[model samples]
Target: MISVVIPTLGTREKELIRLFQSLSSQTLQDFEAIVVSQDNHDKVKELLAPYSFPIQHIKLDQKGLSLSRNVGIKYIKGNIVTFSDDDCWYKSDAFEKVQSYFDQHSTGIACFQIYDPEKAVYYKEYLKDPREKVGFLELFRKSSIEIFINLSVVDKEKVTFDEDFGLGAKYPSGEENIFLYTMHQEGYKASYVPEVVVYHAKPSLDTRLNNKAFASKGPMFKRIFNTPIGIALLTLLFLKKLNHLEKPIPFYLNSLGEMFRYKKSRKR
Candidate 1:
């Protein structure tokens, strides 16, 4: 059986409803869902109450995505454990494709492509490829599949999301990257199935900008490169060049705004 783990926070309830609905309609029905909501258990329960799946909603008082995921994994009892973000909706046959790929391959990690719902034109221009196998490092960069593992394989290999990096924490990203990196280091194989796709609604421009700015200088970058100052400088220079390429004035203005916000946050 497959156990789908979702680590969520204050997500859009409507989007989550759609996600659960999509999962319920999956071609493969031998799966359970485990939702770890950080201090939002009541809301998650209220929203998922209508669903007929074996969903176990766990509450985590802390506000870290990594911690929430750890909590969710503790209760998982499936041979294949799948992960999905609350805001992401899987296609009808996504899990089926994943199961098929896993059955054929002896890999520890499997990933899939992600489509942006708002970018219809871009989606048409790109992302029209079938599923294929890929290396772990390539999966680390482009694959959107959250880590799905076989519980039996856990003892043989060690992998966990790094709490220092992820959303709503000091690091704005790189949790998945670090997890996959660790898995690869432990000699675990990974595959990329393009057909097992999920759709993620992009955040607003403002939220994207904020996340980007924070991610550029976040701890994840520092850990990966060991050059925080260099990364910060490069990000600043890139923002300057990007501004010149499109909207120079607004880009610099936003950069300055982000810098000020960063400084103010640091002072606190």
Candidate 2:
């Protein structure tokens, strides 16, 4: 069976309705939805009851998206698991395609594309060709919503999302980057399928080199690489994306400053 763990603040009643409604239409019925609500348990409970699939409403007092996902992992009874955002929904055939791909492929983790149905475009530009396997550079571009995992291949290790790197955390991003990198280091195989399996709204920002983006990315890149190398890469990235900045030097310096705020994770 497939398990979908969605982390939410329980405020998206309207969007939840739309998400569950799409789940109800899914051609594959062998999946469970685990909604980890960080607030308004009663409201979320009320909202999810009308859905056709079995729903596990997990309440969490904590606020971090990564923390909620780590908690959600413990409650999963399905062999195949996927992380989901409360506002995103799957296509009717999405689960069936994923199950088929997994049944045929030996990949431990798989990443797919997200489409913005209303906008008539992909959630972000995707690689045109599917990759049989991918690594760190590929993971950096992926959002949490596009990932699905085969639990059996990875259950032996103590793998969980880093709470210090996601929404409600110090850096506000790169949780997936760190998690996927760890999985790769653990010797698990990952694949990139060039198909759109889920639908989400267009992001308000897409890697624009703004002050907040610069600040968040500093620690993210630092955690992903050696300090000196990370600093070099960060500087290179700043200069590379300089066309997006009005004051390139100050924004570049902000990122340089924040990189020091995070000491790189010790080797496993």
Candidate 3:
């Protein structure tokens, strides 16, 4: 069975309804959804009541996306696990495709394409040659919503989302990257299926430009790998933003400084 775990702040009732509605329309119906919310359960309870499939609405006072996902992971009862956000929903054949891929590659993590209604293309490079089976590095080109993990592999590896990263945490992103990287490091195979399984509504440009989102990368790299990786990442980030920002150099410097600070805190 495939288990869809969603970590939500319970604020997007309209989006949640749309997500559930999409799930209800999936061609494959052998999945369960675990919705982890930080807000009162009553609000979501009413919204979820209309679904035909099984859904477990879990509420917690804690507010980190990773924390909520970790909590949902503890209660997962399916052999395969996939994550979704409140604003995203699956294609009708998505769960079906996921099951098909996993059936063929029982030991591999399956990744598919995500369509953004607002954007002409999302992750264009990664989207190309969807039939290609990629390694740890290639998986970085995708997001958590685009992947379906084999729960047996994860359980054996004893891996969970890092509480320090992701939405609602100090670091607003990179949890998915770190998670897939860890999986690859552990010798798990990652398969890229040339299929669009999900769709994400575009986030605002302000959210994308939020310094907190990029700031976490420095510390995350330092803590997970080393200072060299952190430095390299910061440098690469600078080059990536070289043409777009007015003061990319200062931003990179500040990121490196934050990395050093985080590294120091780790030693203490």
Backbone collision tally, model 1: 2
lDDT of 2 by residue, 1-268 (tens): 8999989998988898888998899899999988999999999999987776888889998898888988898888888898888889899999999999899988889999999989898987788988888856777788888988987787634568878777787767778888888888888888999988999988654354567667777787777777788888888887787777767888778878888876654422
Candidate 2 vs candidate 3: the lDDT winner is 2
Q: How many angstroms is residue 140 displaced in model 2 relative to the true structure, after the best TM-score fit?
A: 1.4
lDDT for 193 (candidate 1): 51
Cα error, residue 159 of model 1, in Å, equals: 2.9
**Which lDDT value does model 1 have at 178?**
62
Q: What C-alpha lDDT does candidate 3 achieve relative to the native structure? A: 0.79
How do the residues 68-89 of candidate 1 rate in per-residue lDDT, one tens digit apiece? 7767877877888866777888
> Alpha carbon lDDT of residue 27, candidate 3?
92
Evaluate residue 76 in candidate 2 and report its C-alpha lDDT on the 0 to 100 scale.
Answer: 85
> Which candidate ranks first by TM-score, i.e. highest?
2
By the lDDT metric, which is better: model 1 or model 3?
Answer: 3
Ranking by TM-score: 2, 3, 1
Q: After superposition, how far is residue 191 of candidate 3 from its true place, in Å?
A: 1.1
In the range 133-179, model 3's lDDT, one tens digit per residue, is 58655766778988888876656335578777788977788888888
What stretches of model 3 exceed 4 Å from their correct place?
118-120, 204-206, 263-268
